[model samples]
Target: MMTEQDTEILIVGGGVGGVSAALAALERGRRVVLTEETDWLGGQLTTQLVPSDEHIRVETTGRNASYARFRDLLRSHYRAFYPLTDEAAADPHLNPGAGWVSPVCVEPRVILSVIDGLLRPFVSAGQLTILLETRPVAVATSWDRIDAVTFETADGAEIVVSASVVLDATELGDLLELGGVEHVTGRESREQTGEPSAADTADLLDMQGVTWCFAIDHRDGEDHTIDRPARYEHFRDWRPSQLHGERILGFERAPEHAGDPARAYLLTPNPDDDPFGIDVDHRNMGGAPELWTYRRILARRQFQPGFFASDVTIVNWPMNDYIGGPLFGTPDAAEHRAAAKELSESLLYWLQTEAPRPDGGAGWPGLRLRPDIAGTADGFAKVPYYRESRRILAERTIVEQDFSVEILGDNAAVSYPDSVGVGHYFWIDRHPSTGGHPGGGGRPQPFEIPLGALIPRRVDNLLAAAKNIGTTQITNGSYRLQPVEWSVGEAAGAIASFAVAGATTPRAVRNDERLLAAFQEDLVAHGAQLRWDSALRW
Candidate 1:
């Protein structure tokens, strides 16, 4: 049996984007329902076990208030629970002087608690309904509008949700696929978008590889040898020297502007712990065992005790990431997933058996996979960190021209008149491919989130609220960060509110200056920075 529920706005995907949208809509006094495929609410922050990875300037530069609220909630949670010195709370960024990004280094559990606390109010208010373990399987649409969405739960129960505005914030843009919306999957052709680095043709699923991250704790003088995976012998001999003989961790020359790669390493006693960073010359192997060993350098005795402790988190472990080209085009997606899992298992086995010990010993066979730590039955992350999604073909697709270093200029960046949000990250942490662009790497310039990107060319009642908006293959690298995802989500919520209140479509809100202004004003009131500035401005 199926039942239908109606709301003013329905947000699919209970990740940072979906939660942000739900909060925004609720604040606007609109009826909203947020659904998640998993039991947890916070997507990447909670289930994924990915410690926050925001640009340095997020606190000051990001234009999304919900993101800021998230940060505040994190700080408040830490204050209430952790036994931290007052200094830690006062200096939230961890780095005393670095205002670039607030590096509130925290544990995954703490973040999950905070996210749950933030959503409690809305749950109680009835304005927001959170349906967890619910997967949206279908979308019902008229000629130009979305009428309702149908979701299926783990128990085979189906529920139909109706809303005036549908926000596709799903990690993989699942709704966009179910709704029959036209979208690009893998990578776009170079000729199609004129992106210097675009692929030869448009492969909608030609997305950046997804990582299955996990945490590890190292205890001194313990033997932890996980069974060698079926593919262990292959990877053992197939060392990509770029990552040293260890098969995972390696270093490379920093950009010429940053300084000589050797010089970059000069300031460090332990190359890993040296605050002076190493330019990942080439991270081709997707943080395999070699890469995992490299990260182990950071867990020096000085930074924190337990260099020989019972448990420590080794985050950059080898895990699942679609390896050969785009995952969507792979002949056997399930086979690829199985192979990836084998690769991860192999890395783990290597770490437990062959990895060098602090005392020059061999292996830690006792290393156990902690699903409880990663919030999954498999020790890997709860969800693959999806780097791309079903982007709507919008009236103005945000291309590299809008964010390119050549176009935006050095020291001076462009700000869109219809800016909805802001985000800034390295131009592109491109995954190494056989035919991808080479030597075109450099620092990414600041970028803007225009209202135009949110407006679909033909869709009437839906707006993208995550990485699935209207970015070219090139620009997604920058806009796919956590803060930016929240920004897009916040903007979508505001737009949904406007659409419901004014009885108009997203295109109308974007095309009309008056309506856009009102929406922007509301965003500002909610703590978003709409305008740009020389410092912390994108």
Candidate 2:
């Protein structure tokens, strides 16, 4: 039997975006039903095991108070549970003198707990109903409005949820596909958007591949050789020239800046002394050792009693990302995803059996896949970190010209009159250059969020909250990141609340300046960074 529920807002994908939208909508006194494919919340934080990849400037002392609040939440979690030295807590950069991209190093579980705590209020208030392990299978829509969302649970039980507005926060823009929403699936050719370095024509199939990240811990003097994965031999020899060595785990630049890219060397075992500051040649120990060392450097002391330890997460190894060459043009997408997963598992197997240790040993067979560490049963990210999705064919598609370094260089970055939120992360990463696109990488110019990006051209009650929002191929690269996703999600929630209150639609919110101002005020009240001020610059 199918169940039916009614809410003022329907938020899909329980990730950062979905949760943020739920929180925002709840604050506006609207009823929100939030659903996640997994049992846990905090998509990137909890499930992905990715210690939030925030821009350096989005930390505690950064420009936005909301961003600071998030940092404070992380710090508070550490303070409440883990006893930290005053020196550690008082440091402005969180790590004091340590020059890391993010200020804090937190366990994935802690983040999950914090996110749960944050959402508890709404759940308790009865304004938010959180359905774990529930996925939206179908969207009941009219000609221009979504009437309800149909979700299926783990047991195959279906529930139809009716809402005034629907927010698609799914990792891969699942709703956009199920709802028959107009969207772009793969890459757009450079010619379509006139992006200076776009490929000659669009290739909807050439999407950025996803990664299945996992954490590893090292113990000293233990032979942790699990077993060589079935496909281990193939990956052993798999080296893309971009890696600069035989190891695929090493660093490379963004595709746009292929020449003279910043280089990152692999980590090797230094038993006698700490090789903390020393730079050495021939450091590439294939790919396995470097992957372990990358994690070790983050928290050397965490693996006490062992000579050295780390919470090493493999991001760019051969196991995941199934794009490029024949794989890119494959007709069977599911097969590609399966192949990618197998590849990642193979990489994991090699790391456990053949990876070099600091004690000059081979294979840390003791390497365990920490599902508890990642807050999921799969020992991988709860959901694949989707880089691109079916973006809506919005009325006002934001193009690269609006935020290009060559065009807006040294000028005030494009500030949308209907700016919803603020974000700053490098442009699209790890995607291949197709369709005659320039094969290089460069720093992305700062960009803004316009109301049109959140509003569908014809959809009356649906809004995109993450990478699924309306954007050209070139522009999606710049806007798809953790902070920006939050911004989009936040805006979607605010807009939903405004529409419900005014008995209007998204288009009305964009067309009415007074209503837009009210919405902006509501955003400010909820700790969102919507506008830029010179004095508030980071």
Candidate 3:
């Protein structure tokens, strides 16, 4: 028997920075509610499916105009409902899964149908409410604000809400450990963030390692193998001494730059050999080494050749990366998220039985498992893609020399006069950890986002939109992707609608420089770029 409500902005993780902080606090009229532990709302692009990794001049410059209108409403929902192929319909940047790891690689139910058509006009003018599957589980607070939270729904009940401005936007910032705030979980040392690639000590269980992504297609003579994983021979004879031991369900890994070495990829899936440029660039990681068109989302030569015949792909490579632990606050966090969904069902039963093939055989029983492109019946991805969170304790934390291209070699990143947004990556990708810590990628230099890293050194109104800001676990691996969590959730919903229309406080609009230049001029009159233009670098 628990109910209660009230809102001015509550947010709590609807993901992709709580739907860009409830579309920047319902286009600044406020009164939002948000919530969502996934019934789908584009968190990591629809229930953690992961695609929009951006930057390399995202179409033409550093992003955020509401994340370029969510990549222009996902290429206007595949040009207003797919069928393409007139040269992929007059190519104006249509990469609808011509995927070499994202240039708008479509489908996670078309990013939950462009985030339900951009929040169905603030949930039909009731000024947004959302809820979906819920999950917050108690907060209340007082001495430092955050007066109520509670949640817990997907059937169980209990509601509670109450808000003045409390973003957190979950995905592991679970209301900064249920509102006691002052965060910072897993990995912090090189003497606590002097970060020469950290970890000379502090290891709150290291972190980064959460995969569980899925979605496949294939179909040659059809077999669809599945149902083998009950710890399929313990992840098929697992091997990870930080990968030198290899056998990460085969297909071999370790070599997207950080001190390179371990190799062996090539999955092919559609290759008729050479000349297949789909235009990649996740700093060359997806510059195609061919793991089935590396995250290909649809591309049947961009539709219309007999209306498609299997080209969908998405396995989030590094052979189903589940560095064996950490999915939550640990106590073996539900057996490490059920052994990372049994190592993504034993890497789809070792790619449907022993991989290898080239005219030489092994498996692929015509691959399968689409579950309507992972809206999930059991095909995975309804969550589990995180690359680290629970960060705050902020008042500006972001280290790794504030944007290391080997310690700002050419100089950029670290501007912040309370900056507010802009993000880039090409390094500091970090992924192998569960305390084993082999993660690597390291290049970095394009960053920005600092509104004192989304406040919170003492909570006040609690912001930190996603990947729980105020970085460092080596800058939360480049501010944890998807267009920097949609510009750190449209700058925490335009700083909770300019601190609830100026009763004022997000650390008094970031220590008042005349309320931080009128909230960065209302976040650049609602387009929110904040900085990063000086002839854009990589």
Q: TM-score for all predictions?
A: 0.84, 0.85, 0.34
Rank by TM-score, highest first. 2, 1, 3
Please list the Cα RMSD from the true structure of every candidate, rounded to 1 decimal place: 5.1, 4.8, 21.4
* lDDT (C-alpha) at residue 122 in model 3: 76
Prediction-by-prediction clash tally: 28, 22, 1
In order, candidate lDDTs are: 0.65, 0.65, 0.81
Give candidate 1's error at residue 31 in angstroms: 1.0
Q: Kindly list the per-residue Cα lDDT of model 3 for residues 189-216, writing each as its tens digit.
A: 8877787778789877778788988888
Question: Which of the numbered candidates is closest to the native, going by highest TM-score?
Answer: 2
- Judge candidate 3 at residue 525 and give its lDDT: 89
Per-residue alpha-carbon lDDT of candidate 2 for residues 484-508, written as tens digits (9 for 90 to 100): 7777887888889989998998888
Q: Of the pair 1 and 3, which is ahead by TM-score?
A: 1
Top-lDDT structure, candidate number:
3
In terms of lDDT, which candidate is stronger, 2 or 3?
A: 3
lDDT of 1 by residue, 33-140 (tens): 999998887776666655555665665665466677777776676556544444544555432111112254445666678777777888888878889999988888
